[model samples]
Target chain A: MTQLSIDQIQAGDELPTLSVDVTPTTVVLGALASRDWRPMHHDKDFAVNRNGTRDIFLNTPNQAAWFERYVTDWTGATGRLGKMQFRMRDSVFPGDTMVIRGKVTNVSTDDSGCAWADLDLAMTVNDKITTSCKARVAVPSGSGDNPWKRRGSDWQPNGPGNSNAKANGS
Target chain B: MIEIPNEVGDWIGQPRYEEDTEFDVERGYIHTTCSSVENGNPLFWDDKVANELTDGPIAPPTMLSVWFRPHHWAPGRKKQAQPLQIHFDLKEKLGLPEAIMTDNTMTFGEPVRPGDRLKTRQILRSVSEPKTTKLGQGRFWEIEVEYTNQRGEMVGIESYTGFGYRRGA
Candidate 1:
């Protein structure tokens, strides 16, 4: 895997664009993986009749996970995810081709010497932005060990910790 | 005509998850999820590439909420009640038959690995006043789900927001 150091990354850098040919199978796969059995995500009848939606739509968590994969795919395994906030504007139905595009908007370093990049991403289909993604991701500092290992090496099961996107450190 | 229940405040800060502790995050499932999104990234499926970060491959950071789901065969699975849903009567009182997702924010805690047992709890964070929008008279509901591994390490947090609108215009 190619590791991108902080110095090598700069603001205004355009990340690769990904195009997805969404289908009923992809919609179901995402819902099944997330364990979301909401009829709106599976049962077409329930979605149209009961929920008043056109068809089975992608759940919010499933879309968030897709954005998460997009960022990490560029940052590699060493990339530590700090925070992500995205808004779903419209529903994404099966048989829609979603084109995802993103760009590095800003870069900064925390007091701990970890480099963080802020990105703006969007999912577009039929010339409409269905979801808008804004995120801050931790990346390699170009020197020393990866920040996550240096900070959170100990994995405790009983310890009370939060992984919410609101907090700076997980 | 919809308002948050008077007693709903009491349920905040409570553990929101049901009884199951084991996570179903396996490589096969992860691959399917990644593929479904059209992401053929190596880290999500390539053990050799991911092994460099940890002893084994890890699930996607955004996939945190995926692990806290209830099983299919469980009773009342069709209407699986989440923590806040079980404790607070917000939706029922709203009389809203339709739910629309508006926003989401997630924080990554520890790296979720294969075979990791996750313990989750949902806490009611806050609810907004009934406001008028194009959809109808609705209030925004937000809740936080804190997840920890079996070893007690914080895995991650996911907060979901939605608008429950009246059944008909």
Candidate 2:
């Protein structure tokens, strides 16, 4: 388990990096997970012919996940995502290994002592930035207690509540 | 050449409204990829956790991207796309020589769970005349979409900036 305090977090703190090979299978499967039946997202030939795309590209949902991973992984289990924003600069296609990165750009505390941070984020493929954004994450305050932690009463360890639940099988 | 009137151009930029639109969130492979990329655990798919955690089936925070899964883009439109993307379909169908996605921004809020019927409203933000570029002059417009969930709670907002260029302009 990772431990972090808002008082320890400051602007310019580097968030962890997530490197993944963006494959067509993953992209296509993602569409299924969301029940998004848009053929262009899965069928490369159909997309190239019908949608004028060069090849299968990452959808908005995929980009959003990338942003979430960037924030939560560092903030720990209790860290809840508050707000996230991303701009698609280029297409992410099959066989592309993207390096998603972020850094703490600013940190502040609300009147209620909620530790809020601004993160500068980017996803790079082939050394090119394909997606970039600024995200805000709500962290536990300096008091060393996260009010949201107790709410995980329903969270089942090693169960579906964990985003890494599938990795166990793989 | 078909020269669209300046008034029509203005109209394209003019803000319009979209309301009472309902969409759903479901579980599928997209969740898997999202999980892998984000290092999420199985609980995201654990129906038990979802039902117990949020008092309903919860979708990933990114569910907004797929909220339109059960709905059509527009009632009578042939091509399908995000509501914001479809806003420019009229220009595309008219054989407009050039349109490029100029800018886009999305601000996310609450996580949209399954069983949450979302309503999205849109407003025309701004439209600008053809601005000179190295390639040629291009027209631009901006539109905003405000989304509210079934609880009449604000979920998120999206702003789309689109630009179209005349062929060889």
TM-score of 2: 0.73
**Residue-wise lDDT of candidate 2 within A1-170, one digit each (tens)?**
35467877989889878888888876776666555566677899976765456787776666777677666678754465555666767778888998888889888765445566778998899889998887766666755565233222221112223222111111
How high a TM-score does candidate 1 get?
Answer: 0.86
What's the lDDT for all of these models?
0.72, 0.60
Q: Show the lowest summed lDDT stretch of 10 residues, model 1 chain A.
A: A155-164
Clashes of 1: 18
**Per-residue lDDT over B63-106 for candidate 2, one digit per residue giving the tens place of the 0 to 100 score:** 56456444545587776545454445535633454554545555
What candidate 2 gets wrong by more than 4 Å, as runs, is: A1-3, A31-40, A43-54, A142-170, B1-23, B27-57, B69-82, B93-102, B131-138, B164-169
DockQ scores of the candidates: 0.51, 0.17
lDDT of 1 by residue, B40-129 (tens): 666677778777665568787787777776565665567645533532356776576666768887777677788888877777777777
- What DockQ does candidate 1 score? 0.51
For candidate 2, give the lDDT of residue A9. Answer: 90
| Model 1 spans with C-alpha error above 4 angstroms | A152-170, B13-25, B75-89
